[model samples]
Target: MPDLAARLRIEFHWRGGPDVVFADITEWWRDPVVLRDLPPALTALVPGPVPTVVLGPASRGTLLGALIAAHLGVGLVEVRKNDRMALHSPFHIARDLPAGYHEGGARLSFRRALVRPDDRVLCVDDWVESGGQALAIQDMVAEIGAAWLGLACVVDDLGDRAEVRARLGVRALLTAEALQAD
Candidate 1:
């Protein structure tokens, strides 16, 4: 399944261009193993009783979060892109662009009410390009007074795990190189 997904990914990159590479689960899920293996890898990154919060623009990360939550027998939360009418009292967080990437001053908002104050959260995304998005989610968790377990992604492209950890104050679980090597 991973192989098939990898093949699809390669094809996507080849035909769709580099920016269109949808390596994240929520974006391109050709198999179930991508979802299956995510939890354990995430667990290895953060040692705690943390429930996973799927960050949105809903992608493979959302599916991965649902699978992980089901596997762990925990609840799931979503960090949405737009403040819909359903999210009346939503919490907002500004995501800074990660180092080296263009398009600065981009910010994302999340609802704090979606999670409980006592909930320990592990932010899950399909991919980590800059680490800024992940860091923004972490900041939202912090603002809500919820303990953050860490950040987990199907693919981490930045390669600077230490910088992600230091800036986000949590460990990054996966890297693009690791996934490609697998």
Candidate 2:
């Protein structure tokens, strides 16, 4: 795995209860020289059959997915949080929310047309912990009859959760240990 924590400056800030570490990859996302490095790094983990499409959930996943798709010369599919597309399917997701919600969860949806039966999909995310979003996305991918390539993230914060690790088999550029290091 690439030592992203060493290359990038990660800062710690208080979210609510305690300190939350954020990897400041602002330049990495903006500059091509940096972003171009990600595809090779990620594809090394999911290298076998060429994936047909890259799927990412609403928000930051879109950016990471887009870069991967472009690198692989495939299509990018955006999974939205709300009903943004005409023919969309929704799935319930529960995770650690950043306060304001006593109950933590949200509904995410994806356009049905973005995926085709024969399309091999690789799910991408900015950060993954509970694997809730990936699980929900897996259901959506199944509905479309697409082959799931596996989950990839900029950071895998799931710690030692073997269940989630076995399920998503997440390939990450950074781990919680690396990201949380001061």
Candidate 3:
């Protein structure tokens, strides 16, 4: 098998054009090579301590987080999107996003039990663009009294948000620019 970057480029596609460009990553999840390699690749992106648990946003992030958590022999906490559903606990934490990449504003919440004060957390996701969700996760981590390690993603398109990037210690397998290169 070739390198992951080469495989990603081969399978990834950008739909539409001059006005709206949509980045399609569904194909990446279908490929066995990508599924098996993504966990380790994402793990390497961390620039801090080994996380005791992984916090993944709803949907795609949940899948990616599960894989990474399993690979690292850790636990996973799924942060729901715009959903109040959470594990029955008084310690549940939620953060509201004023703006997001897709949703104008959303709520992200998770059970406080999954993450503890002693646990170190790493947020895993398919992509990180605006950093809105990541910041929310960071807040949840704090509310749970857990230590925030960093964030790992498949694509990092945060533009010039140096402060967010530095604060999150964001790392990625490919830059959004890489996917756009044809």
TM-score of each: 0.68, 0.78, 0.93
Residues 1-182, candidate 1: write the lDDT tens digits.
34634543543331246676444343345545544655676656666565644443344556767766776777777555444533344354444444444444443565556776787777776667767667677777777788777766555577656777666545445456756655
Kindly report which residue stretches of model 1 are placed more than 4 angstroms away from their true locations once superposed.
1-28, 50-57, 86-107, 169-174, 178-182
Candidate order, lDDT descending:
3, 2, 1
Q: Candidate 3: global Cα-lDDT?
A: 0.87
Q: Kindly provide the TM-score of model 3 when superposed on the true structure, using C-alpha atoms.
A: 0.93
Model 3 Cα lDDT, one tens digit per residue, 1-182: 77998888888888888999898888998999999999999998787689999989989999999999999999988989867464344667888887645748887888767788999999999989989999989987887688888899999999889899999889999988877775
lDDT of 3 at 75: 91
Ordered from best to worst TM-score, the candidate numbers read 3, 2, 1
Worst 10 residues of 2 by lDDT: 93-102
RMSD of 1: 4.7
Quote the positional error of residue 79 for candidate 2 in Å.
0.6
**Tens-digit per-residue lDDT, 58-125, candidate 2:** 77898888988999899998877545343332432222223332245666666667788898889988
lDDT accuracy of residue 64 in candidate 2:
84
